[model samples]
Target: MSSENQELRKVGLKVTLPRVKILNLLDQSDERHMSAEDVYKALLEAGEEVGLATVYRVLTQFEQAGLVERHNFDGGHSVFELDSGEHHDHMVCTETGQVFEFHNDEIESLQKKVADELGFELTGHNLVLYGKPKVN
Candidate 1:
């Protein structure tokens, strides 16, 4: 069986064409973050017979299956990325709308400390920093 099929089976999801295509697209995409519209466009460009609604549905299913992560970076649209198991934060460029991933032990520790001080367990958290690039 192909890896994609195995992944679908592992998640208890039936290996449908849409699910496998969407999963492969996300996994092979050079851009880590992609919105539903972006995925739809790519599918159309590749001559795949997929609807935008189907793309959205597949993405939502992937998110529920823990195969992908969704982020509402701009508070307007949500982008999806494959969940690679490693934890990382995001930095968004306001001017260009580009997203970058970063990992920092200090920041992680600080978050844990803050949560401990507040007497709340840090089950999960998302940190997104927005900024514009400086022009020299």
Candidate 2:
């Protein structure tokens, strides 16, 4: 069995063509985060006949199954990326709508310290920064 099949089975999702194709697309794409329209366009470019609604359905299913994560950025934009099982914050470019993932130990420590000072144990956090590219 393929790795995609194994992953689906592990996630308690029955393996199907659309699911496998979508999973492969997500894994192979250069852009980590993609909207359903982006996925549909890519599928069309690849000569796949998957419908937009089907892409949305499959992406939602993947999100529910913990196979992917959905991030809603500013301007009503939403994107999905494979859940790589790592904790990372995001930076979105306001001009390009691009997403960047990063982790900073100092930032993490500061957050923890702030939470501690507030008399709260930080259980979870989602941090997103937005800015446009600066002209040199």
Candidate 2 global CA lDDT score: 0.95
Which residue pairs come into collision in candidate 2? none
Over the stretch 63-130, how does candidate 1's per-residue lDDT look in tens digits? 99999999999858999999999999999999888999999999999999999999999999999999
Once superposed on the true structure, which residue ranges of model 2 sit more than 4 Å away at CA?
A: none
Query: What's the residue-level lDDT of 31 in candidate 2?
Result: 93
What's the residue-level lDDT of 128 in candidate 1? 99
TM-score of each: 0.97, 0.95
lDDT of each: 0.95, 0.95
Q: Spell out the clash pairs found in candidate 1.
A: none
